[model samples]
Target: MDARLAPFATTPRLVVKIGSSLLVEGGAIRQTWLASVVADIAACRADGQQVVVVSSGAIALGARRLKLGKGGRGSLDDAQAAAAVGQIALARAWAELFAGHGIEAAQILLTLGDLEDRRRYLNVAATLDRLLALGAVPILNENDSVATQEIRFGDNDRLAARSGQAAGAGAVILLSDIDGLYTANPCEPGATLIPTVARIDDVAHMADGRSASGLGTGGMAAKIAAARIAVQAGMPLAIVDGRRDHPLTAFAKTGHGTVFTAESCTSARKAWLAGRLTVAGRLTIDAGAAAALATGKSLLAAGVVSVDGDFARGDAVEIAHAGSVIARGLTAYDAPDARAIAGARSDAQAAILGYAPRAAMVHRDQLVMV
Candidate 1:
């Protein structure tokens, strides 16, 4: 594993997520800080690196602009209203900052469903790629105005991680209030900074007592969760203090953060599958079936030992072994169809089901090898 921080300095593609606390001051937008961030991003682009910024502060900006006190957590409707109001100012602030730097910034708002649906996910990825190709920096934010309980990323931390994965970024820099992960809160006795985290699981113990910042929904816990998502999607992540002067620039030159290296360089499809919050169902396969899948073959109905869970066609599902998940894919058939075809002979498929759409339960294009 190449764990050096310098790799981030020259990384061709980067995702930088700035927290609300860093972007707002006295309950209002801080144009100065936004300008500094834009300058750093411009410097990165000057070095030939493509950059994407996943930013928070819309809610804060909205709340301040509307003069709404921070007492609306009790009502979901009120919170959404704040996000709705803040999103505009947030985008405008970003646009104006980038304009000063002579760069065009595109506001790309996304919902959890956009990332969950394979087709839409790929479309968003393609659009972001095209924007980058055109020398435009894509400013990403969660679609809080439209997202609900079941389809929300909850905070910009996860959104940033997903953006990094979707953009195939080499590194994801999570700028937060704190410098990095520590054995304990650095303000407390016996606390020490943990410079490197080779495995995400290693930091689980350190995240227990951490709490969210007053200005942001995500705390250190969310940052760790985001790191796990980024690592699983084959991207390295660094959590550093955004409060520092030129945080991204300094972190790139010196290792002043908790660096989480990716486990492996998985393909984009597999990364998408791995990052999903839930699978629709499971397709159990025999040993031959598992081997075929491992060899990059499509999953045929004949190899399925059983199907479990209620799922519709085009929904994500898991391919399992004795117990563990071996793969995940978009099912070509609904639950009833899949259940009826499991363990059935290929020749008998049409006879039993009265119809068949190809023989495979999932085509190779829809399947992601675990």
Candidate 2:
């Protein structure tokens, strides 16, 4: 157990990353191991903690279902096909396990752009918060079926850290085949595990670029990359040996893995958004919307009186009331579409536009009062 890992119990929100090897064995799902991990999540929930899972193994499961040879699928198309088939099975497996605990599992697939784009990032962060509020555990995976090479994140490790950042998780855990960072390959004699990492850069050279499992893409180097992201986002990260059952619980008790302390604290969510985003346009809101914003309520379409500038969906915009700037946020509709639906009831969105997407002109989660 590591002495510096005493703060694990206090985390209010946690993001857990389950690797492919931890979930799949012999071309099949590791049901017993998964059940134990689910138990760990339920326990966390019981203690009033919100949990999100960033999981891998879809392509592996899909390949097994299609009976593809184990070594590697030949091309991106082959991998995409496998992921398309396996994603369903993976979702079902998670749903079934969570159902036993009276917990709902929500599936969310994302591409690399979702995190990189400020508007899309805010939308995703809002969605994660909503799911947690509704007592549902978000199960996120890369949209591998539709992701091309240019937009693909080859490993879930980086995605896990991004998930924590998006959801404002207090902690991030990576369950892997190896417990922690090692001075050298553990398979070789004289290699020793490093219990705690105060600075990832100092130990960056210790990563031994080990071979990845046939079912997985990330290696130790990828996990290191993830740790860097988590620590920068004000959350401690742990890399634990997850080959055994009750992995999370074991970690809680022993704290035997390497804990990477956060180097800095993240700013408030709205402040962070305000600092990073560029306004795309402006929306003139009525007095009612201005009042609602003060009360932390979502900006409704009916409150919007005018739309200014030509901006597309998921673009940041300003909200003005009484000829004064009130707030800034991401718009759910394009400028033309916003004009068509402005000041209309949410229920009227479908009729006003050919197809209604979201009810809010700008969801409250993405909006920050200026």
Candidate 3:
């Protein structure tokens, strides 16, 4: 056990990548095992953490439903067909499992292109943020029904890493059939688990490209690649055994997983918010609000003096004070609504907007002081 894995259970935002090999077996979903995983997720939610799940089982489950040969290569059409059928079952199963714990589950299907394009990436990020803000856990999987080799993420490992990056997850957990990385395939003799990876390349040769289960597409190589992507993006990742009951809880308590540490990307996130955004409009705030933003506080509607521009919710906008740019951030309300609520108290949000949304016009997490 290692203390380094504690963040996997304690981080404010987490993305858990569940492999199909661990989730499905013998032509059906592993109900008992999945229940245990759900329990772990429930525990995380109970601790006030937001979680996003990148699940891989649609193709495996679909193949079973269609009576396709298990663990064998199939035509792209066949794979797509299986995904179309299996996705429904997978989503339903996840919904049911989370519902047992009074948590709502949302299904989001995407392809590589969705994440590769800048505009679509932002849209996806916004959607995930909204879902988390609404107290719902998003269950994501690749949209296999229409994906081809050229545009598809060959494995869910990379997809999970990218999804976590887009959602700004603080940590990622890869629940694989194996416990963690080893000098060699653990199934083989003389392979010992490596508890921590400081520099992935130093041990990149250690990956034997072994996939523990026929149902899962990713192997050690994929996991390593995922680790590289996540770490560079400032999100720590962990690879742990998922076969046991309450695996997440166990890993946290026993520190049994291989933890890949990475620095937080606060400056990078702020830079993106400040420079990469296309200013959709402007929000003129009072001097008090400007000072508050300088201190890293979210921009409140109470401090907003005027709203200009035709920006929609989630669009990036400049924050102005006395004809000077103070900060920039994503708006939580549309231009019309923002105008109506300018200079209003936080408590009046619901009454003024006809529905309760966020308290801040620009959340601190999405704002950058310029």
Candidate 4:
């Protein structure tokens, strides 16, 4: 494997995105292909890797039931109707496929707002984290049935990118009909694959290219948009050919496709957190918590000595120690709740918040040391 591609191979947790074209053929589920992928995922889980699958195919499946064409119904209502019907079948297929490998499949549906809104984003992150911790493969998809066009992510490529962030995934894989980015459309002469993308903008001109298989709707442009989101969050995103059987298996071994490394985004993200977002609140931590934060640990509520400001769950807050701003990050709890839980014990958090799976005040991934 290429050293630049090492992170994709060694990531402890990964998000694999399956496009509708890869999952559905003429409106029916691709059973054999899906089974093979599930087997690979089971193997990954056995090796202590947590995997999340963000799939797109509900509308396609529903179109089959409605006798509609590959483009699905022309109107938004028709599309939503198809999604409502197809989502059930899609979820069922995932559950059955994973069940074959003795793995439980958990379905999670979300609209764009789920990831855009801080409070909802925290809830989603918590849910995804808990599902992975319980050793279950979470099958996530856009809530197309209920999502209005105004709030829709427009495509699953962006949805998968957001899901990766919500899941705190180490890397993302976009399984598409095309192998990866190319200098020109592969059909044209002198076209060649660009294996590693260090910066998305340099090769973004190729975004105008069409899908080679003509089976996918997102095209290269959508994938490029997805890569931007992934890279900005400091995650390596891989765009690989998924039309073939056992794509993940081959990808794990060879990684033969275009990968957006965005190696610099890790530091970039920290920089963004350290200065980009407006500080809505401030948290003062004890020396122990300050030590933990210095070592790159999450800020647990137990370590918080005081909370200032009326910030919401998703608000950016500063971590202060000894009258100095040590770090900054998105908060997981609201002002009242954080104030209530300040210095609270971990075991007693549930009792205090009256909720399950209360996360850190600031997760390490979002925490930026200053």
Off by over 4 Å in 1: 1-3, 185-188, 208-211, 283-308, 319-326, 342-352, 355-365
Clashes of each: 0, 0, 1, 0
Provide the lDDT at 102 for model 2.
100
TM-score of each: 0.85, 0.72, 0.71, 0.72
Best by TM-score: 1
Model 1 scores a C-alpha lDDT of 0.83
Write one digit per residue (lDDT tens) for candidate 1, span 1-370.
Answer: 2346755776789999998888877767877767778889999999999999998887777776666777234356766777889989889989998998899999999999888888888899999999999999999998777788888888788889888888879889988888889898778998988888888777876774233557777888888888888888878788887886677777766778788887786777878887776788899999998999999999999899999999998889999988888888988899999988888777888887887556579988888865
lDDT of 4: 0.83
Error of 1 at 14 (Å): 1.0
Shift in Å, residue 53, candidate 4:
0.3
- The collision pairs in model 1 are none
Candidate 3 C-alpha error for residue 336, in Å:
44
**Backbone clash tally (model 4):** 0
The C-alpha RMSD of each candidate to the native structure, in angstroms, is 3.3, 11.2, 12.1, 10.1
**Least accurate stretch of 10 residues (summed lDDT) in model 1?**
71-80
Candidate 3 lDDT tens digits, 1-370:
3447656766789999999888888768999999999999998999989999999888888887788875423778888988998999999999999999999999999997787645888899999999999999999999999988878887888888888878878889999888988887676898899999988878888775556776777898889878876776778899988889888888887778688887546564564454332477999999899889888899999999999999899888999999998788889999999999999997887898898858699999989765
Model 1 per-residue lDDT at 307: 90
